[model samples]
Target chain A: MIWNERIECATRDEMRIIQSERLSETVKRIYHSVPYYRKKMQDAGLTPNDIEDIDDLRKLPFTTKIDLRDNYPFGLFTVPMSEIVRLHASSGTTGKPTVVGYTRKDIQMWAEVVTRSLCMAGVHRNDIVQIAYGYGLFTGGLGLHYGTENLGASVIPISGGNTTKQIQLMEDFGSSVLCCTPSYALNIAEVIKEMKVDISKLKLRVGIFGAEPWSEAMRKEIESKLKIKAIDIYGLSEIVGPGVSCECEEQCGMHINEDHFLPEVIDPETLEPVAPGEIGELVFSTITKEGLPLLRYRTRDLTRLHYEECACGRTLVRMEKCKGRSDDMLIIRGVNVFPSQIETVLLNMSEVEPHYLIIIDREGTLDTMSLMVEVQEQFFSDEIRKLQELRIKITKQLESVLGISVNVKLVEPKTIERTAGKAKRVIDNRSI
Target chain B: MLIKQLSVFLENKSGRLTEVSKILGDCGINMLAFSVADTSEFGILRLIVSDPERACKVLHDNDFSVNLTEVVCMNCPNEPGALAKALQILSDNQITIAYLYAFSTGDSANVVLKPDQLEECIKVLQEHKMELIEASTLYKI
Candidate 1:
């Protein structure tokens, strides 16, 4: 079931040679085209000539989200706007987004990688692929869309939401493959139950779910509920999207598309590379991206990379599913949520105190966020209706901002624990 | 008059009620009345004690979600029809009782009820010539 067997089943030395040539060329290109990267290299007292191979990649300074944010809109693009054909952005620390641009070649490369990913999930030319990922500024939807097409499969470009219609199309179109976030897959399963649609009627045989971290238990739930093989795919907007790596049929670990993107795990605190099979923050170097070429970009996603050959016969390096993040970012239902984002919503409202605690838990297969906020002394009321209204107001504001429903609990003033140092913001009890 | 009632939240677990009672007993807080309101998962144990503030402090120190609420306590005659007459007055006045528990002491039955409208319930009971037990006398009894 290995896709692109020539590349995927390459020997360790062969991958290094391919990675080395690509990395050297990418370094030289960025050093010449992007001043930000040139400055970082110059600051490190290095030149493109200093990086002769993939081993010299460590000599280059690591790029971070903050660096991306500092660059803002198109500052990171290596090519002119005329050459860039597409753009995708994920949420940044502030209101602005971390932007990525893609040239035509880059788009084709994305399609190829994702095609390999879909093929790894056992999808083929005859399979009717359903792209449920959102198709807008986010890269998940269109990334999978073109990739399914590139794989010579019949693709249904049905973007996310409209659960009822999605089910109808799944039945009528005989969609054999589904692509979306794991949580959205669960949401679809829920809607399917409510609609009472006969699962047997649908031809769904496999689901390639990603765009957020998920657990084995969640995979089992999705598999049993949808009666399909639930496969975990890994990608982020920074280094392509939804196709950087995916699980082969063996399902042990996701095979990283090392030819297009290079992954390195490092201790987030020490900035030192970790041994293989050790968990650390994931960093990527998009050696093949034409528009936006990143070198040693810190993704902040923590996971372990395994070099052992998989049963699927892919000699490419496989990474365990991301365990968690090295930062304070929280993913709720596939949407990134920062406690500071919740803080911004609370501080904007006048009736509540600034103190809040975010509690995240797993209710069955879905993740739930419950925010406990303290009420101001003047705004506190004995009336249950008034308190409920305040809770609703907070919930609505948070939902609008975070793009996920939140349960808000308004407590008495000073009910939230006060800490002299950094306040504890999130309490995650999920076993995942 | 309003009596201070201690409401302690308890997870529905074995020995949770026993733990609360033990804490109160160890603190030497005499419980005059106790009742439990529960669903399947959790329960609220409501107690009228000799020293409610101290009992609340002890329970809270033990990590219980404790709150002090005002409940109205009135004496009903120790007869079958006596309770119905007092309830009819509340029903006629459109006052809803959140919960109620009764205990007999000294030939009279004491009915401690948490009404939806505490102030209105007191006023209605006073107009109906019902003897409302103040916290001081009720604690001693």
Candidate 2:
């Protein structure tokens, strides 16, 4: 079921040659077209000519999320606006969003890689895929959509949310494959149980879950609850989206789309490549991307790469499930949120003290964020309505900034815990 | 007349109310009238104490978010329609009441009312011949 046997099962030497050629071309294009990359390379005392092969990847400077934020909307795009056929964005640390563009050929390449990923999951042209990842701006929905279509499979295109309707479509359309976040799959499973919908009657057989880090225990829970084989998919919007890697039926580790996205695991401290099979921050270089091709982009995700051949017969390197993040970024309901963002919102409001605590918990397959804020003495009111109004105001401000509703609990002053001299900001109770 | 009511912010957890009462009692502060306004997560305990300044200071030293709020206290006969008649005066003058609570003594009941306009509420109630208790008198009682 491998989509491209020549690329998927290529010998190490053959793959290295392919990577060398693409890496050289990408380096040359970005150096000439993008001033940011040119300046970065110039500061590093390296030129496109210095990058001759895949071996020279470490010599190139690493691009981080800060670089993307600095460029903002279109400063990093190597191609012109007309050349970009599609655009997707995810939340940045602060107010602005990190945007990525795709040219026509880039989109085609995306579809190809995702198509290959679906094949790795045993999906064929006859399979019906119900895409539940959110569409528009977020990469999960449209990325899987194009890939599923490229595979010649029937796409339900049922974007995220609306659990009852998703269940109804699963039964009516006889969808054999489901694509969504792992937590949403569990949520759907709970709805199915509550509604007493017979899971045995549904034609669903495989679920490809991604866009958030999940655990092995959660995978077992989703698989047993939904009566399907849950495959973990890995991708970030900064990379080429969900098609970057996917797990095979063997379910050992997700197969990295090495031909399209060159994968590396580096020690976060020293920024040096870790020993094989050692967990480190995952990095990617978009070798074939035309619109927003990145060179040695540092993806803060922490995971190890396995070079051994998988039972699924694909030579593409496999990455173990992401353990955690190198930074303090949290993915709540597939939305990237930083504690600093919440701090910024709290600091702007005068009614509440700057001291706040964020508690993340999972209630019935959904992530819930409870923010405990200390009420300021000047804003404390005897009237219940005024206090309620203050709570609602803080909640609204937080939701607007974080793009997710948060449960704001107004507590008395000095209630949030402080250890030594520093205040503890986040308390995550979720296992994943 | 306006009475200084101490309002304390309390999380809806066991032993919090008891702790506040214990702290005030230990400090020899007598609570004249108290009302609790609560939601699911937290509660606001409003108290009229003999030594409000001392009670507020002790509660503040104990790390409780306590503040002073001015509320109108009126003395009404301990009859069924006594509260209704006093409230009718404010209602006729279009004076909105935010919240009200009462405590009965021997022959009359002391009603604590927080209205939208404090000065106008006092003038309207006084114009209707309502008995407005002074803060010192209420605190002594």
Candidate 3:
């Protein structure tokens, strides 16, 4: 079932050889064509020749989203505008979006990697992939679209919204492979229940969910609800969209496309590499990109990398699910609160479901955090004392885990607004 | 005798209590008696209603966390010493009352109370020969 067996299941020595050659070529190309990267390396007193292999990646200057922002629209692109065939940008709420461009070969490489990703999820040529990721400058929709086509699968490019339609088309089209953010998948599952569509009737057997960090609890919820094997896919617009890596059928860790992308885990504080299997910020270097190949780009995602062989028979190095992004960590009254940590606590409790919103507001100079949790149908009843006890129990568990007392509010089922994309979990109203 | 009481948790908002009462009123469920317990952030509304299950259903459907609890009700003589006599019997029997509220009706006063030990309080009341109102009779009233 391995899509690109030579690439995905390559031995460590073979991958190192391919990565070494690609890294050398990419570093030289970007250094000569991209002035932004050239100045960065010149200022760091290094040359493309200095980066002879993948080991020399540490010697290169690290590129970040801020660096891309400084470059703005096409300042970081290594190719001419005429040569670039496609362009995509990360959704930026504030100012300039992080722009990415691809030459024809780069787009082909993107398709190849994503084709391999779909194959890892057991999607075949005969399978139907319903892509719900938004199409446009956001790379997810089109990236998966082309990849599904490349894999010879029938793709339903039903891009994002109109939940009822998404479900109807999914059933009518007999979609076997579903691609979207995990939160949107959950929203679809909720709508399916609301519409009383029998889940057993749907042809979904595999799901490729990503674009935001999700937890094991969420994976379990999506899998059981949709009756599919939920596989986590990881990518960014900077790293050639949603096929930088993917979890195989083993469901252990995501196998990074090591031949095209070099993966590294570095300690966020020290800016040094962390020990194997230790958590740190994930860094990637695009070795085969043609349009805007980057060198040592810091991803800000926190996760560990495993190099061992997978039971699914892929030797491609795998990365564990990201804990959270460094910037996504919320400091609540001097306590660190990760939405994943709260998710972990909620998923362990039987009375409450994993759907929740963390609201942080300020009173005078102090900060206050409130958790709005949905009570399960079996848990929600006419027993006020039991509800109060459940609320208190959740509050205590959250307080113990977060080291700050959280005001737990019991909300009715499905009261929270479900988005067709990444779920907004934290709302800090201190500024407003 | 045990009487059913409905307790609801409400956010400390201006129109929260009104919303609960309005929903109950619209459902034609009459509140026989009720009490409010408040903290800085939230409040609990304990009610003795004509139909506990129906009132609870209506309030819950309106998104209120509601519960039903069994409370002891007693009929005391509507005299100055009548209340003191009932309290003395319980105090002597070592049965503590968590909370109690009384309303006078004609010549008799009905007092609803939550006791630490329901069986002990009832046995003490019967031994003292105090009139205990049956829930069926109270509901009819």
Each prediction's fraction of true contacts recovered: 0.00, 0.76, 0.05
lDDT of 1: 0.86
Question: Model 3, DockQ value?
Answer: 0.07
| RMSD to truth, every model | 6.5, 1.6, 17.0
List TM-score (chain A only) for every prediction.
0.92, 0.97, 0.77
lDDT of 2 by residue, B57-141 (tens): 9999998999999999999999889889988889889999999999989998989999999999999988889999998888898
lDDT of 1 by residue, A45-80 (tens): 999999988889888899988888899999989899
Taking all chains together, the TM-score of candidate 1 against the true structure is 0.73
> Which tens-of-lDDT digit does each residue in A1-432 have in candidate 3?
888888877889999999999999998898888888888899999998998888898898788877887888898898789999998876332234578999999999999999999989988999989999888877889999999999999989999879899999988889998998776788889899999999999999999988766678879988999999999998988889899999999999999998988999999889999988899999999998988888888888899999999998999999998776766666443233568778878888877778899898766434688998876545653334556778889998877666568988876446567889999889878542
- Per-residue lDDT over B1-141 for candidate 3, one digit per residue giving the tens place of the 0 to 100 score: 888888777656688888888888988887777788755555667888778888878877776667787888899888779889899989988898767777666787889888889888988899889888887787767
Residue-level lDDT for B101 in candidate 1: 90
Q: For model 1 chain B, where is the 10-residue window of minimal lDDT? A: B37-46
**Candidate 2 per-residue lDDT over residues A1-432, each given as its tens digit:** 999999999888899999999999999999999999999999999999999999899999999888999999899999899999898988887777899999999899999999998999899999999999999999999999999999999999889999999999998889999999999999999999988999999999999999898988999999999999999888888888898999999999999999889998999999999998899999999999999998888888999999888888889999999888898999999989988888888878876678889999999789999999987678888989999998999999989888889999999887887789766889999988
The stretch of ten residues in a row with the least summed lDDT in candidate 2 chain B is B82-91
Relative to the real complex, the DockQ score for model 2 comes to 0.79
**Greater-lDDT candidate between 2 and 3:** 2
Better of 1 and 3 by TM-score: 1
Among all candidates shown, the one with the greatest TM-score: 2
Task: Sort candidate 2 into its docking category.
Answer: medium
Cα lDDT for residue B114, candidate 2: 92
What's the CA error at residue A394 for candidate 3, in Å? 34
